[model samples]
Target: MDLHEYSRYDAVGLRALIVAGEVTAAEVESAARRALDRVNPEVNGLASPVFETALGHAGAGPFGGVPFLLKDSGPMAEGVEFFAGSRSLRGVRARHDHDLTRRFRAAGLAVLGLTTAPELGLSYATEPARTGPTRNPWDLARGVGGSSGGAAALVAAGAVPMAHANDSAGSVRIPASCCGLVGLKPSRGRTPTGPDSGDPAFGALAEFALTRTVRDAAHLLDAVQGPGVGDKYTAPPPPRPYADELGIGPGRLRVAVTVRAWSGVAVDPEVAEVTLKTAELLAELGHDVTEASPALDWEDVVHGTEAAEAAIAAPFLTAPGRPDPARLEAVSRALLAEAAELSALDLVAMLDAQNRVSRVVGAFFTGYDLLVTPTLGELPPPHGTLSSGEEGHTLRGWLEKLFAHGPFTVVFNLAGQPALSLPLGHSVGGVPIGVQFAAPYGREDVLIRVAAQLEEAVPWRDRIPPCFASKP
Candidate 1:
């Protein structure tokens, strides 16, 4: 297999070839290395290359021998350096495999390397002072939405069919929107974050990946959806394998669509137009699509999100070998200061706020089967627009900026709902515009079915990025 042939197949397709003996796993791995080498320089998506170690990976299962990349953050894999895009933790390595990483190995994904993220995964853009910017494959001048920006870029550039990603505040969906890939943030507790951590960010964070196709997303969820030992909670098991959901028709349903951001940010006109068109398309498909939004207290939402982000950054900043002040980015340093001042009562108040917001959003879902919105408030912005190193940003101001760029995604994190972003629209300039479909908690099956419908309705298989690995 060569880079061209290798780049043509998604993970499932590559697995099929491997299973049928059409191409050896070694050949596929070699081709993936070639793809990575060809594209990584242009996109700067890779944070650490463990090619030799990955070449020795051997396993058998559903995705046996398929090449994959881990995000620079967690679910950690033993011996793989995990900096979380931070200069302070530059040489840190995981002492043991995170439960999800073990599951990925059992599922037969060959771990290639770690991808870039913002410092401590703080920003909506992946321009880490530690690793520089992760350029969007669609347009080199634009940002790849963070913190899964690197994973999305590699998958978009055909360096790998899919790569590890996670979401607490739109990390997965934002990048998928920016890069024209399928990003699914599973219901809280649907996937593990265990052994080392339990329900990080108070169940706001969910682990998953970004993929080139919906079926790949479905298949992967099937392989890695269960809770790990000692998990705080678990999502209800699906009625059937998620892959089966792809073929099942999402029966006529009520969908609430909105272009307005809950935070009141002015959504880009192009993004709004695409979202309205997507709603029209849903109506044409026989569903009752209405322009409606859940009433949310933006203040509560902001406070809750800040608390969660602070919780995520706490241990890293408070560790005995704490990050040196100068080594940390401006925003990270600000977050450290904020984390130090955070009181237990403050955390409890924020958690209360999150619970209230979740209840309100949950009630809205009781009236609608799904909520459709633009995955982002705007198109992918130019690099440095959301830089972590830029000085003089309070945590509140920084989050406000992030919410402005990606106001549509983090609400679902607070609500703990299953949300998916599909590349169903594009800007006049050819940048991909993602439309998000969110379902009630533990209803990824519903999102998957509807996503499959849209994937077929607006096929993006031929929309290749300029920095693609297969390009001559």
Candidate 2:
């Protein structure tokens, strides 16, 4: 198939063509490679290529022969070098497939290569010191949100139909927002991270993908959800496949809408306008939408998140054969120093506060079926606007600055609830603006249905980026 034909189909559509004998997996792989060749140089999304490895996996599972990219930070496939956007661990390779990677292979996704990420997945931008920046497909100078920025850029540019991505504090959703895609962070424990790590970041992390269609996100979830062996936690099973919820009405429900940042960070006027417009659209669809924000102690949530991340960072700093200091960035070094200062008791106290905040946020959800907010507080900022290398800011000061730019999405990560970012509108400057819909834990089914409703109401699939592969 030609690149245009290949770029037009989502994974399911590509799979259907392969299954129907209308196209060969080899042909599709070639099309994807052509896409990579055509766009990767300009977009800077790919960190490394595993084209030969991908060729060997063609025809292996449900998506056998469909090209797929794995985010460099996590969701590792066995033997794939995992640099995590760090030069320090540049040659590190996973000894075994994390459960999710094994599932992706079994489901027939041909792993093409690794995508770029911010160093250690810590930054909201994908400008890794080691791999440089992964440019936004929408506008090259603007940042593609990280650490899943590479994955989102490739899919947005039509290098792949959908790619693996994970979210801890909006990595997946932020990029989806910036790149005009569908990004879903499944409920905590909904996707496994086992035999290597479990519940990383103290249950603040969840894994899923960035897709061009809501159905692709739903189908990919069907392929990857469920607990792995020796998992520390598991989400309650859905009554039916998540994909079945698509095109189905979500029923009349109460959805709380807020343009106010939980931390009181001032949102850009354009972003707030887009969010209110989305709320109006939801109301037009017969759902009750009201202006409301969750009640929580913002200080405790911020402190708790920092403590949890430090606790997670501590091991990496002290791990045997750790990266040399020269290879580490200032922000990473500062974070490591912060982690070194924390006592075990401090970590425990942070966990306790997080649990308390989770309960408070959970109770707020009791009054509404869903909460909606702008995925990011501002439009995608220009590259280098958030440089960790900037002098004079302490690590904590730098983090606060970062949060001010993206204060809306991280709270749900702390709460371990399912959240999705939908590309429902665009900024006056023409950049994409995604609206976030968060549901109570284990309620992705609700989020998906409502997203589909919004998808039908304000379609975004035809809004292709300038760097798109189907441009021919």
Candidate 3:
């Protein structure tokens, strides 16, 4: 198959060709490798290559022969290193498929490689001190947002149709917003985090993917959405397959829009402008759009995130023969220091606060079907702008800096709602800007329906970035 032709089809289209015997999985895998060769060097998106392993598992199943990338953070395949973007875990290999990874394999996604992430996924940029930055495909000097930044970069650059991504405080949506793709964070407990540990980071984290199309995201959720045996929780099952819901009308709905950052920061003017424009578009599409947001305690979000980070990082800090202090990033070290001081009582208090915020946000959703907001406080900022530099940063200071990178996103993580970031606008500087649509728990169906409608109303599929791999 011609490389250009190969890059044109999304996962479903490629799957159709494979099923009809028009293109073999091997040919598609070869095409993906070529795309990676052309784009990965410029993008710095991949952490490691597993092309041979992908080749070995290319054919059969529903999405047979489709090239895919798995983010380095989780959903790891056996024998593959699960580095989590740190030199500390460089030699730690997965002994078996993470339940999510097993489902991806069952769906016939050929996992071509692992993608880069911030060290310990503690930052919003994909610049791990060990792996360097994953450059934005649209602008080389700018960053690809993280920790799913590399996954977004690869998909944006046409290196693969879609790749694994997850969110804890908007890892998936942040990058998708930065790179012009579809990123959906399924509701808490929507996807498994088991056969390893339950409730990743106290249910603040959820796994999903970054895709170029809404249907691709929907199909993937279909493939991987379920509770593993002994799961601590499970999302309410969709009435039907998410893919089947794509073409369905969302019905006339009420959407509350906000350009103000819930964390009390002013939205970047360009981002705000685009958000209002999107609200207008939604109104035109027959939804009741109003400028409103829930009045929840933002402090609760900050404290909850701090506790979760501490709980998640404590294990790494206590691991034997951990990375030398010199190797760890400043923010990561600060987080470790803070986590070490946190007690069980402190965690309980934070959890109570988080649950209160959840209840508050959930109550607001009763008045509105969805909440619309800017996906990020600003366009993808310049590299190093949001980084808590290597010196003199305290844990509180570092957390503030990181939250500022995505002030609008983490609230939903706190609420455990299904949120999606859609590439709906561009800034004056021409960087892509995204608008987020968040729905109450177990309501991804509503989000997808609206996403599909907006996709048709303002199509972005042909808007390729400058560093794209498939450009003729």
Candidate 4:
């Protein structure tokens, strides 16, 4: 296979070619490197390039020689200087290989570099002072949402089929929506977050990646989903290999679709149109689709959800001995301040409230296999829309603003359920739009299966942005 062609292949295709010996992993790495050279300049998606190590590790797993990038926020790039899109740790380097990155390498992905992310994964837009703006491949001026913004940009630009991304909030889905890709944030504990901390508070959310192809996303989930040696929790065992289950038809799901969020913000007309269109498509596929919503107390969640999430996220704020106070964002600072004032009673109240929100959502699943909504209420934001360095709004206001802008995707993080963002719709301006589908807790197999089903319904693989197509 020509390197040019390999650059365009999705994970499955690249792996097949590598197995067939028609192409070598080295060649894929080379092609991906060339792609970075061609596209990174225009998009600023790649934070650092690493082809040499990738070449040495080609033909390693199911995705041998497949080009991929890490989002720079998670545990994967230990000893490799992960900036996490913040100025505070601009020169930080990974001291060890996170098990997740090891698993990714073992699965045969030749990771050639790191993708861009916003400061501390705090903002949805990916422009950081350390790295210039990571432009959306679809529209240069438009944002490639954070913190996986850079990965979205690169993959949308065809630099790679997929890249690693995680979402505590909508970090993964927001970018996937902006860049037109499939992003699955598996159930909490579906993927490892280990060694440093057992879980990031509330046990609500964890790590996963975004990809351009549903099949690729599903395949990686199979290769990587499991608790490492010392994880706090594990998603209940999947019914079957997710890749295998994709072949099984999703018999008429009692699909409940809601375009309006708990916040009372009307879903953007464009997002609503696509969400409804997707529901109709699901109905045509013989699934029962209904317009419905759960009793989501949006005002309550948005008013103080960050405080709850922050309380859960406290350990990660400081290391064992010397705390890295510099990396704390304004929102983080606000939460810490609140946490100090919180008593045992307040802690109980917070946990109880979080559970109640999840219960409200879970009850709806009793009547439906899944819930569908616009992944983000609005479209991709302009760069710097949610800056956190104490600008005008208070830290809580900034976070609340983000929740308002992206009201749809974070509840699952709170619900501890498996949710996925499927890239099946678009705005009239041609910006990519995403629809979120969530399954009950411990049923990632269902989430991935439905996502694959939708992938077949409305294919997005061919919508590669012009920036990527130009090189190939």
Candidate 5:
């Protein structure tokens, strides 16, 4: 298969070709490797390439033979190096396959390698001191949003149809917004963090993947959505396969639109214009659209997130033979200090705040079926704009900077609701702009339905980036 032919297909499309004997899985995998080789140099998306292992893989299932990449910050796959974009965990490998990784393999996604991330998955920019930066394919000088930033960049550049991504405070959706891809942060517990952790980041993290199309997102959710053994909680199951949700009209539902972020970060005019236009389009599509926002104490959200992050960092930072300060990034060191200062009472306060915010947002959702907002407050910033390696950052101050760039996404992580970012619009400069659609808890079906509608309404599939893998 040629790079152009390979790049045009989504995961499902590729799987169909493999299933029909039109092309073998090996051929598809070869095309993916070629695509990766062609683009990874320009985008710097691959953190660890395991191409040899992928060649030996003969996956079987709905997506059998589909090329996939795992994020360096994991849903761990045994034997693959697991670095959460930090030097502290450098050279470490998972002893066991994370439940989600097993599920990906079972569903027939051939794991190619690991993608880049910000150190400890902290920043919205994927410029880790350990792996440099994963540049945005749309504009090489800008960043692909972080944590899942590498996954987003590869998928955007047509290296792979979809790849593993996780979100705690917008890691998945932020990068999706920046890269013109489909980033679905399933409801908390919709996918597992299991045997290693019942819940990561105090139930704030949601494990999933980034894809180019809404149907691909839906199909993947169908393949991987379920609780793992010993999970702390499980999301209510969808009534049917998530793939069935596609092509179904969402009906005339109540949709709330807000360009103003609760954190009071000023939305860029271009981003605000895209979001408002999306709302108008929803109205045009016959939905009841209204300007409404749930009341939130931005401090509570920020504090709770800080506490969760500190807790996540504690185990690593306090471990036997913990990484030296020189081995860790500045923000990570700051996090270690913050974790040391955190008391049990601080965690309790975080839970209290989480409960309060979830309750308020839950109530708001009782009235509105969906909420529309810009995925990020600003466009994808230039490299160095949000570096974790930069010195002298207090944990709070660093989070403030992070939230300012992505004020719209972390709230839903706090609320444990399902949210998705779709590349629905673009800037006049030709960079993609993402508009996020969030649903109430356990309502991914709603998100998929609406996202598919928008996918059809504002077609972004043909809008390839200049640094595309297929381009010569």
Candidate 6:
């Protein structure tokens, strides 16, 4: 295969090719560097290119020669500087390889670069004013869903088969949905988080990568998803080799479908159409899919789950002798100010509400193997809506817009279950739309099996974005 072909192969596919002696680690690394040199200028996805570092590290493992990129948020691969996409962390460097990075290397991935994220992984769209916009490979003028937007763009453009991304509030799934790829947020504690921290945010979530194929996600999970030494919450044991579950096929699932609550944001007709079809598709797959609204008060403002996330994120933000306090944007500053005023009772209320939401959501999942919803209620907003520092927009308004439109995602984050965002549909103007599929906590194996089956049913691998060069 040519270098271009090497660029397009997912990790698993690349492994097969290497075992067949069709490619070498050096060849794949060279291909990735060339592609990064070619495509990154327009997309602004690559934050820290590590071509030489990757070339030196290449060789051995299942993915020994396959190329990859990582989002800059969680931790850095050894030798590469990790910026976390902020002005404050501009020159900071990693002293050692985080566990996930070491596992990926052991499994044979050649890390070539780091990707862009919103400042401190705060924003939903990756249009940072400092490093400029991380443009969607599909539409350079549009915003790429962040904070994994950088990883998503490179993978979508066939620069690499897969790249690391972490999801807090839909970070992994959002960018994967935006870029028309497969993004899976494995259950909390499914993957090891060590060296810098263990289970970021007390087991509220976990991290992984977005990929072109379901098998690629599964293979990576097989390679890297393991219990660390001191996990706060432990997921159930995965079936032997997550890839084997892909072949087993999902049994008939009790699938539930829900629409976005009327948040006053106009639902894109294209998204609605695809969401309805996706439900039908699930039903056709011999599963029960019902168009039912979830029973709960989503709009209740009882100092709820959002506050819990804020509380979990505080020490990292407020820690002394770290990123300078003055360097934070006004939005972060304002949030810190609001957090300061939160009393003990306020925190108790937040934790209590989260418990309530979890109880309700958990019961709902008990009756179903999967719940399907639109990943986003609408298409990408016009650029500059977020991080523009625009006025008359309360933080509540901004957050409500994101949550209502992105209803299906954070529920799982709160419940700490596994969720998958599959880019299966397209808008009339050719923008991609994603559908969410979630299973019981630690049941990522189930979601991956069904998704691989669905992917075969409706092949999306051939769908290429307009902005990416089809032939390099």
**CA displacement after TM-score superposition, residue 73 of candidate 5 (Å):** 1.0
TM-scores of the models, in the given order? 0.98, 0.97, 0.97, 0.92, 0.98, 0.93
Largest lDDT belongs to which candidate? 1
Model 1: per-residue Cα lDDT at residue 203: 84
Displacement of the residue 48 alpha carbon in candidate 4, Å: 3.1
Candidate 4's residue-wise lDDT over 193-268, tens digit each?
A: 7776666655655677878787888899988889888888877877788888788877768889989888777678
TM-score of 2: 0.97
User: By TM-score, is 3 or 5 better?
Assistant: 5
Q: How far out, in Å, is residue 258 in model 5? A: 0.4
Clash totals in order: 0, 1, 0, 9, 1, 2
Which clashing pairs does model 6 show? 63-108, 64-108
- What number of backbone clashes does candidate 4 have, counting pairs of residues 3 or more apart or in separate chains? 9
Instruction: Report RMSD for candidate 3.
Output: 1.4
lDDT of the candidates, in the order given: 0.91, 0.86, 0.86, 0.76, 0.90, 0.74
Positional deviation of residue 114's Cα in model 5 after best superposition, in angstroms: 0.4
The lowest-lDDT stretch of 10 consecutive residues in candidate 1 is 50-59
Predicted candidate 2 versus true structure: per-residue lDDT over 33-74, tens digit per residue: 889888999899988864574824526577888788988887
Q: Report how far residue 363 has shifted in candidate 4, in Å.
A: 1.8
Q: Report model 3's TM-score to 2 decimal places.
A: 0.97
- Model 6 off-target regions past 4 Å? 55-58, 262-266, 299-305, 308-321, 388-397, 469-472
Estimate, for each residue in 1-472, the C-alpha lDDT of model 3 and write its tens digit. 8768977888988899888889888888888999999999999998986556572352567787799999888888888877788866658877888888888888889888999999888888898877788999988889989889999999999989999998888899999999999999999888888877776778888888999989899998998898887789789999999998888999999999998876787778888888899999999999999889999787888888876787668668777656566677788778888788888899999999889889999999999999999999888978888674477787667768877768988888888999999999987777899999999899999999999999999999888898887775
